[model samples]
Target: MANSTTLSTGKTFAWGGGKSPFSVSYGKLMMWIFLLSDAFTFSSLLIAYGFIRYSYQAPIANTIIKPLQHVGENFVEEMKKAGLFVQDHWPAPELVFNHFPFIHGMHLPLFFVSLMTFILIFSSVTMVLAVEAGHRMKKDEVANYMLLTIIGGAAFLGCQAWEWATFIHEGARLDYNPFGPRSFAALFFIVTGFHGFHVFSGVVLNVIIYLNVLAGTYEDRGHYEMVEKVGLYWHFVDLVWVFVFTFFYLI
Candidate 1:
């Protein structure tokens, strides 16, 4: 198996810093710093969400991205009280999210969003596997997993595009709209959409890495730690979604 690390050449090797002066690489360090900045951007958005909710006196989780299915016995009752649906007081997320354009009939909740999250998380797994394969010098296996990761990324983007379409058409406005049903609509879109943009950008980055893998550029260079770095970025995007899912949809 190939070594996990690519050593520095000449003088820098002699210096013998424990981590080899950023064992990851200058580009990777820059990527991490950029990711930190992106983290702050999300912080500002989530904080703004808190401020707006405080202003709206909104029902909190009473509505928005309802659960895809019932959990316990009374989950339906609790969901109904959230204001998203009207009926035998069954629940809303299922109807609101699942039904989509078919409000007259019952369906499921946040189906598309759930699917997107699944794709992203799956991509993270594939990316980690790719890095593992790289460590073993299984170039073909690494490329396969990396390709799958790229496909997962594409699937995620497709889901996000569809989500934006649904949101924009939902009749809510910056002034007032249907799903904003309160301030929640605009805030949900802004927050989720911002994250989706990051996902799209991440997909682009993945494509670049995938191409490099296929071209054998990284192999000849004698190191694949960049895959590990990119994997970090991919996982961060997925982690942010977890918070978004809980706060925006499930609460």
Candidate 2:
């Protein structure tokens, strides 16, 4: 095995000066490092959230109230009638997210968020296609797939904004919440909101890459590494959402 100094500097001049040991580009390696660090941050936040939630549940273990039962045309109103808002009992994720666009007084639990998740996952697929196109030197295909990916990302962000609005309108804030515990709303905003910011940033990055593709920047360089790089970030955004959905919604 090579020594640390030799491994760090690489075997040749072309491989020296911040080259990766695992044969990745400097930029890509840096992205991996940054993502690894970010994973730790998210893991810490999630662990803290779990600890806080567990502690909060301990005191109310015996007194834990069942979720309000609802049916018929006015479920939201029914919930309101029964004082079934996100208070006293742990709010059911389905009950909380049972909202749809422009159709007031409907109980569409998880429908919208499920759609959003589908879009995000599909965007990851489009990103993979874009990267494949880049490899094949199919500039037009790369551009098309990248555009689709961007549209998917933008739609997801818009849906997230709508979700945030609904959450706020239904009473959620950093310090105050209708939820059983204050930390429910706080962690929701901090964890998922931070994740939304990442989505927004990824959308901007995709837009930049799309424009560069249009301008044939990669053609000039004889490579579409930028698309691949941004794709990494985009896929990471999508992957994080899976966890958020599990933690915040399903679990």
Candidate 3:
């Protein structure tokens, strides 16, 4: 706590100054490098997804999330006894997922993804505010916004879990979906599901930081710059989602 005040005095120091390797610390630099590498990994995944989608689009006659076809009531009971859902008569892709509220047409559950995107974006904005608060050394302000960001992350994860259930539940199956390039459903599930994992990890990391920050760890250590470093990661997670939204939902 004493060091914090001394370090904060006009950034010019005498006896009570903070010193570390590389004019800062090796840990912070490594974090930055790791983040940069993660950036590339995410970029490659999205680009590969786009390439595969477009390359196979020509051969794929239909690409849509359709409803399950075949038997009506007692469908699951009969099929599960046989260890497979009723797959006798399948509906066309156009007919399955095309039902919109009062609008007779196919519409994917992309709206849910869009909603999740907004949630992440809102969280990122709050994270930015948290970083700003840290810069000003308003520890309480930073803590409040960081908590908002954490809650937002949890909400996003909840939405993602609900969406995954909607996707994997047998009731929502598209007959053609269990297959290959013919089924974008699987790809959608895989890609977005993976992103959700990243978000989940980010939330956990931020929570740990929040705990440490609350324990006077940063203040006692003489700087809250760790908050800013973690914020960089928080922002990166949101940025990756921008590509996810465009590639998975929009395209």
Candidate 4:
């Protein structure tokens, strides 16, 4: 039976039997609330991107030949071999993300970025395994999975740094771009940069929690709720990246 109490006003209030009103811990509930708010923020950015892109559909007459470095050597060569030049136009995402790090001057459309996406998705899988292991009280398995998750998050952040450098080197700026629209440059940097910062912060949190796990802190506490909480955050980071990849790259 639910616990009920009578107030002076003759109103009865019934309470659920648990540490938390809903059966979820305070930490997990707060994390969900945070993720919900963050989702709205990202949605707004993407909605703005779509609106601006659609509204600015008019072609500008000040077209210039695309820089040789911007489209990679192989892309330019293919155009040349076909007796053509890379004319300026609304930037195609495939062409924009064509180059891979360390293998520059090659046309490998979205290759490295695809690899980064796989890394983040794989990290999410490891996060799940970590949470599962925590439930099973398998400390070693949890540690290993958490380690892999941290590495994946770190690698994604490093890749973002390199990508940002390549973009700026190719002449994309807040108010200037070799691409057609200035708003595109501004939005690209703001949206992706914000996401990258979140990934970096997640990695740091994972490392701290991993160390605590290794120290047997949770074991003494009789539960690995900390791991589960961090997993929620890591999963949210990965989920956000999915929308970013789809909206910014695939679209």
RMSD of each candidate relative to the true structure? 7.5, 5.1, 9.1, 5.3
Q: What are the per-residue Cα lDDT tens digits for candidate 1 across 1-251?
A: 13234356423342354453555577788888988998898888888876665554334345344344334433334444555433212222334344333332333567666777788888899999999998987778888998899899888877767666765564445555443245556776788888888788888888888889889988998888778888888888998888787766664
**Candidate 4 global CA lDDT score:** 0.80
Ten residues in sequence with the least summed lDDT for candidate 4: 58-67
Clashing pairs in 2: 86-178
Error of 4 at 202 (Å): 0.3
- What is the lDDT of every predicted structure here? 0.69, 0.80, 0.66, 0.80
lDDT of 3: 0.66
Give the TM-scores of the predictions, in the order they appear.
Answer: 0.73, 0.83, 0.67, 0.83
Write candidate 2's Cα lDDT for 1-251 as tens digits.
Answer: 34233545454543444445677888888888888888888788788877776664332232222323233554445555565543545556677787778867655678888999999999999999999999999999999999999999999989989988988987778998765677888998999888989999999999999999999999999999999899988999898899888877776
Q: 2 or 3: which has the higher lDDT?
A: 2
Shift of residue 80 alpha carbon in model 2, Å = 6.4
Candidate 4 wrong stretches, greater than 4 Å: 1-21, 58-89
Ranking according to TM-score, highest score first: 2, 4, 1, 3
**Cα RMSD of predicted structure 3:** 9.1
Clash list (residue pairs), candidate 1? 62-82, 66-93, 80-91, 98-108, 98-109, 172-177, 180-185
Error of 4 at 126 (Å): 0.7
